[model samples]
Target chain A: MTGDGKFNIASEKHGESTVLRPEGDVDMSRSSTLRSALREALGDKPSRLVVDLAKVEYMDSSGLATLVEAARNARTQKVPLVLCGLTTKVRAVFEIARLHQFFEIADTASAAIEG
Target chain B: MADTKPHVYLELRSDPVYLSGARQLIASVAQRLGFDEMACSQIALAVDEALCNIIRHGYDRATDRPIWLSVWPGRKDGQDPGMLVVIEDEARQIDPTIIRGRELDDVRPGGLGVHIIKEVMDEVEYEAREPAGMRLTLYKRLVQKDDSQDADQAGASPAGSADQGRVSNDG
Candidate 1:
C-alpha cells in the first residue's frame, strides 16, 4: 500500500487487469490522492481496471466525482472499469446519485477480473 | 418541560481538510438521536456534500473564508426525533432558486453533491443571509420500524425533482 498519511492506495497487477484498493475515508481532502492513483493506473493501459472499496467506510461526493471522472476516462480509452466490494454506505452514495446505473460493479475484485 | 435544544457549534475555515471533522460531528449527533447506522452515514454524507458546495462554489475555492456549522437534536414536539444541521457561510451569495443538482442523464463528474444532499436529508432549506452569505439547513428524522417504508419512498424521488426544499432571499 502506498501510504499518504491517513489514506493509502494498494495497487496490484493481475495479468492484464490492475486492481487499486484505497484504504480510509475517501473524502474531499483525500480524493485527489485517489484520483492521481487512478490516473497513473489508467495510464498503464491495463485491459481492465478494478477498484476495491471494501475498506472505505466513508465517501463524500468529491470521491464519487473523482470516480466518475475516472470512469469516463477509462471508457474513452476503452479500458473496462469495474468497482467491487463497495460497503453499504459507499453503495448508498452511488444509488442516491443514480450513478449505480452508469458503472459496472462486482462483488469482488477476483470476480471482476475473471468475469 | 422546556425543550433544552442542546446544540454543538463549530467554526472553521472553508477548507476541504475540515470536511471529515464536520461529518464526524454530524454523524455522532445523528447516531445519538437514534438514527440507524445507515441513516447516520447518510446524514454525514449529506452534511459533507453541503460543506463541499460551500467551499467549492460559495467560497470559490478560497480556503480561508469562514464557515459555521451548528448541529442539534431534532425537536420532539409532535415530530420524529432526529438531527438538525445548519451551515452558515460567509461567502458569495447567489440566487437560492437556481441552486440545484444537474440532470442524472448528463453523466458528469461534478454537480452530484446537491443531489446527494437533497436525497439523504428529510428537509433542506436554503436562504440568502444578510450582507453576503448563505445558510443551509438540513434535517433528517429518525424513522420508526413501521415508518421505514414511507421514509424510503420519500428519499427515492427522482434526481432533479428532489429540489423540493424552500429557497428564499433573506438578504
Candidate 2:
C-alpha cells in the first residue's frame, strides 16, 4: 500500500532477520502501510524486525502509536524489533510524546542488525 | 458552468460544526490543487489544530459572533506558485504577543495549535484585526512539479513529487 508517498519494504532471507525500510512522512494516513509492513516482516513465526527510518521527514501521534504497538506485539512473541536511522524531526515526535521507551532504537541499521 | 470568481470564503459560526467544516475546506482546496503530499498533510493538520483553537478559545464556542474563513491559491511573487490561507474570526481580539509558541512538554490540549502551525508552514502570522476580531494568515510555498519531480528521481524524499499519496486518515 502506498501512503505518504514514500515507503519501501524489501524482504531478504538473511538466515534469521528481516528488514523494513520506511521513508517519507508517517502520519495517520501512512499508519496502515506501516502496520502491514510490520506484520509482513514478522510473518506468522517470530524473527528480528528492523525498521529503518533514516529518510522519514515527518511523523505524527498515529505513526508513533503504530511503532509502539508493533514493539509491544514483538515483545509478546519474544522477537527482537529494532528501529534504526531516525531523522531528527521524527525522533522529536517520539521524544516529545515520551515514547522513547517503546522500542529498541539503534544508532544505525548495521548496529541494529549486528546486535 | 457559471463564470464565478476563483476566491472562496466561508463564515464560521461560534459552533463546533462550523470550525470543522472550515478545516475540511482547507483540505479540499489543497487536495484539488494537486498539491504535493506533504504540503496537503501539513495544511490539513494545521487547519484542524487552528480551527479547534478558534472554537475552543477565540469564540468561546458560546458566543454569538461568527468565525470567517478565506481560502485561495495565491503567490507573493507572480512567478512563484504559492498558497494563502486566511482564517478570520469575529471573536474577541487576541494579543499577537500571546500567540507565542508553547512548550511541547506542556502537553496540554490548548496550545498545540501554535506548534502545529509553526511546523506546518514556512511562515505564519497572527494579528488582531480591527472591529474586534482576530486574523491568522498562513503562507506555504508549494514544491512545484519540476523540483518535486527531481526529488522523486533522486531518491526517497519528502513530499517533493509523486503527488498521489497512499494512506492518510482524516484525523
Candidate 3:
C-alpha cells in the first residue's frame, strides 16, 4: 500500500534476517502502513526481523503500538525483532513509555542482525 | 518581559490527514518563540497526541467533525516563557477522573497517547465544554539549550491556509 506522503517502507534481505526500513514521520496516519509491512515481512518467517528507523524523524504512540504488536508476534513465532537507529527524539518516546527495556534495540541494522 | 505574541486559532476538520498540518503549525510557532529543536519537537508531538485523542476517541474517527486549535506564546504562571495549546472538540464528554494515562510497564498499545501528552507538556488541563464535548489545554515552557542547532521548522503560513485553518487574534 502507498504510504501517501507520510512515510516509506522498503523490505530487503540482510544475511539471514529481513530488514524493514521506514523513513519519515510515523504517526497514527502512517502507522497502519507500517503494520501492514510488518505483517507481510513476518509472513516470510525469517529467523530475525529488524526495523531500521535511522531516517525516521518523528514517531507517536500509534507508531510505538505497531512495533509492540510486531514484537509480540515475532516472539510467539520464535523470530527475534530488533529495532535500530532510533533518533534521539524517537528514543525519548520509548524511554518515556518505559518500553526501552521490553524490546531488543541495536545501534545499526547490521549490529541487530549480528546479535 | 512577558511574551505577548499574537494568538493563532486554527479550525480544522477531524480528518487524520490534517494532523500532519497541525504538527507543522505548532512546531513553527514554538521554534520562532525560541524553543530549541528538541523542545519544538516535544511541543509538536504533545499537540499531535492531543489531536489524535480528539479525532479517534472523541470524534469516533469522524473526518467531517470540527476541531479547534489555538496557539500563542506567553509566560506561564511561574514566569517561564512558553506556548499555550488549546484543543476543542464537540464529541462525547470523557470522564476526566478516569482519563489517567496507563502505567507504561504493561507494554501495550492504544493507551500511550494521553501518557505521551502529559509527559511532554508542562501542564495539561481537560475541561468539559459549555454544553457538550471536551477541551484540552496544554502548556510547554521554552528552554533552549543549543540555539544554534537547526530546527526542521515549517514555514510560517498566515493563520489561514485553507478552510481548515485560519488565524485570529482573539481565541
Candidate 4:
C-alpha cells in the first residue's frame, strides 16, 4: 500500500462473504498491508473471504506468499479464501510458480462470493 | 556478450525500506528499454525477490550492509534480446548448487522468493565473491512486439541517448 500511489483497498460485506478489493501493485513494500487486510477480513469469521484483484497491476512472490499464508489461516478457520480478477501479469506469475491449482480462483468477485 | 556491461549501477543499503526504490528503478529501466507492461512487471518482481533474499539471507536483515545492483541492456547476438541485472551483496558466500526452491506442491508461504526469481528470469547464475559475499546475475529476454507498435513508440521525442550512467545513493 505504501509503495505505489495507486494502491488502494476497500472492504465490504456481500451476503455470507467479505470482499477485500485491492488496487495497485502488490510487492514486498505493499504485501504487509495486504496481509494486515487479510487478517482483518478473516477476523470476523465470514463463511467466505474474497480478494478482488481487478485493479492490481503487478504482484510479486511476496504478494503470493501473503495470499498463501492467509489461505492457510483461512483453512484452519474453515473460511474459504477466494481470489478473483487476476490480470494477465498476475496470472502468468501464478502459472510460472505452478500455484494456480492451490488457490480457488474465480472470474469475478460476485462469482467467488456465490461459490 | 557484446560488451554488455552495466549502463546503470545503484548501491543500496541492505534495508527493506529501499525495496520500493529498487523496484521503481528496475521498472523504469525496463520500460525505457521497450519492455511491455507484463515484461516490465516480471523484471521488477525478479529483481525485488533477489534483493529481498540478499537482505534476508545474505545480510541477516542488517540495514547497514551494502548491496549493489547493476542493469544493462543485452544486445541482439542471435539470441533473445533483453536486460541483464546483477546483484552483489556482502553476505556469507552461499552455495549456488545447493540453493533450491522447495517444490511448489509443498504449498506454503515464505519460500517462494527463489522460485519466483528462477521462474521469471530466462537465465539465472550465481557466483561467490572472493573471500566473502556473492553475486547474482539474472537475464530476461524481451518479447518482440509487432512492428506497428515499435513505429508508434519511435514517434516520441528523444532524450539524448545515454550510453551509460552510474547512480550512487544511500537508500
Candidate 5:
C-alpha cells in the first residue's frame, strides 16, 4: 500500500498465510476493491488471511464496517484472519467502533502471518 | 448570503462516487491551508456525514437535484486557515426537532451521521432558504481550538446546544 491510496496484494504460501496490502481511503466508494482482494486471498473454503494497513492514509466508518463484516464472515467460515500494521489513525477508528477486540490485531505482517 | 467565496468551489450531484471525490478535494485544499492531517480528516468526516444525510433522507433517491458544496479557507480573526464549509441542497427539508443525534448506547448502523457532523465541526448552523431547500453551514478553526476546548472535550447535547450551534430561518 502507498500514501496515494493504492494498495497491493503480495501473497505468500510459505506454510499457511495470505498477505494483502490496502492503501487509500477505503470508504463506501473503494470498499469493493478491498472486498474483491480479500475474496481472492481467501480463495477456497477457508484460509488464514492477513491484511496490512500501513499504507492507508484515510479510512471512514464505512471502510471500518467492511473490515468488521469481513472478519465476521471469516470467523463463520472457520478461517483465521488477522489485520496488521494499522496506523494510529486507523487503530483509533477500530477503538471508536469498539471492534479492536473482535479480531486478531498485530503490529507487523510477520506477526499476523506467523501467528 | 456570505459574499466571500472559498479558494475552491465544487458542485456535486447526489451520488456516492462523488462523495469520495469531495473528500479528496477537502484533504488537498485543507492541507494547503496549513491544517494538520488530523484536522483535515475530521473535516472530511463532517462533509461525508452531511452528504450522507442528503443522499438517504433528503433526496430519498427519487429526485435529481444537485448538491451545492462550497469550501472556504481564510484567516478570519487572525487564525490561520479558518475554514467555512457551506452545503446547500434542494433535497429534503429536515425538521431540527426530529433530527436529534443518536446516543452511543443506542448503537445503530445508519443514524450516526448527524452526530459525527456536529461533533467534528467547530461551529454548525442550519437555515431554511427561500423557495424550497436547506442550507447547512459548518465552520472550523484550522489551527486553534474553540472556546469549548478541543474536539475530545466537546459535549453532546440532549437539545444539541452544549456546543456552538445555531439554527435560523434565513428567509
Candidate 6:
C-alpha cells in the first residue's frame, strides 16, 4: 500500500461502500492516522464503511480505542461499519477487550459489502 | 533451572514514535523464549499498553519524559519458564490501588489498556516508584505446546474469569 513514514492507509470506494486499508503496526504512534482516515470515511456518509485490516500486522489498545470511537461515531451517523481480515494478533486484541462483540466483522471486504 | 536474570534493558523517551520498535524488540525476545506466535504478540501488546500508559497518563503526553523497560527470564513456582517485564517512568505518581479498568459495558474509548494488560499477562502489579512516578511489572508464563490447546480453548470462551490471573495495584 502507501507509506506515511511508519504507517500507511489506502482508501477506495466500491459502489456505496467505502473501504479503508491501514498497513503496518497500528500502535500509539500511528493510531491517529487511522483515526483520521476512519473519520474521513465516515464523513462521506457512505452506505457502509469497511476497514480491511489484512495488511495490519500489529495493533495495540490505542488502535482498538480509535476504532471503538469510530464505531460509536458511525452508529450515530447511521453508517454501517464493518471490519474485515483481522490478523491473529489484531484479533487477539479485540478478543482481549471483548470488542469483537461491538463491531460487525467479516472475512473479507467483499463479504462485508455484499452482506 | 530457570533463569531469573534480566536479559534486556531499554531506555526510551515517552514518545509514541518509538512504540513500534519497542514492540518488535519485545516480541522477538518472547519468540526466542519459546512463546508461540500468538503468545509473543500478546506479550508485545501488553508491553506496548504499559508504555502508552506511561506516556499518556504518567507523562501527560509529554514527549521527552524518560521511560525505562527491562525484561527478565522468569519462572512461576517451579514450573513454566516465562518473561517478566518491568516498566519505570519518572512522572506524576498516584495511588495504584485506585487504578482499575473501566466497565466494559460502558462501550467507550480509553480504559481498555489496563484491562488488556491484565487479561494478557499472568500477573500484573502496579506500585509507586520512590520519589516520583510509577513502576508496572507484568509477568506472563509460557504455555507449553501440550498446554496450548487448553489455552486456546479457554481463550475461545468469554473472558470474565476472576481467576484468569492476578492483578494487584497495591502501591
> A62, model 1: CA deviation in Å?
1.0
lDDT of 3 by residue, B43-152 (tens): 78888998888888998898999998887675423365568888888999977878878987688767998887887777889999978889888877554433212221
- Which residue runs of candidate 1 sit more than 4 Å off their true CA positions? B1-6, B75-80, B146-171
Residue pairs in clash, model 3: none
Superposed Cα deviation of residue B99, candidate 4 (Å): 1.1
TM-score of model 3's chain A, to 2 decimals? 0.95
Going through the candidates in order, what is the number of backbone clashes in each? 0, 8, 0, 1, 1, 0
Q: Model 1, B140-171: lDDT tens per residue?
A: 76555566566456774432223222111220
Rank candidates, DockQ, best first.
6, 1, 4, 3, 5, 2
lDDT of candidate 2 over B39-63, digit per residue (tens): 5766766665566567667766564
Q: TM-score: which is higher, 4 or 5?
A: 4
Residues A1-115 of candidate 3: C-alpha lDDT, one tens digit per residue: 3455747898899777999999889988889999999999999999899999998988888999999999999999999999999988888778768788999999988899898
Question: Cα lDDT for residue B21, model 5?
Answer: 84
Give per-model TM-scores: 0.89, 0.52, 0.86, 0.81, 0.71, 0.89
Clashing pairs in 1: none
RMSD of 1: 6.0
Q: Write the per-residue lDDT of candidate 6 for residues A1-115, one digit (tens) a residue.
A: 4466958899899999999999888888888888888998998899999999999998888888899999999999999899999987688778888889999999998998887
Q: lDDT tens digits, residues B79-171, model 4? A: 455788989988999789988778988888878888878766778898998767999988876545444355345562111111111111210
DockQ computed for model 1 against the true two-chain complex using alpha carbons: 0.60
Q: Write the per-residue lDDT of candidate 6 for residues B96-126, one digit (tens) a residue.
A: 9998788888888888888888887888999
- Worst 10-residue lDDT window for candidate 4 chain A reads A1-10
Model 5 per-residue lDDT at B18: 75
lDDT of 2 at B145: 46
Candidate lDDT values, in order: 0.81, 0.64, 0.80, 0.79, 0.67, 0.82
Candidates in order, interface RMSD in Å: 3.2, 7.6, 7.8, 8.0, 5.8, 2.3
Residue B96's C-alpha lDDT in candidate 1?
87
Top lDDT prediction, candidate number: 6
**Model 3's DockQ score:** 0.37
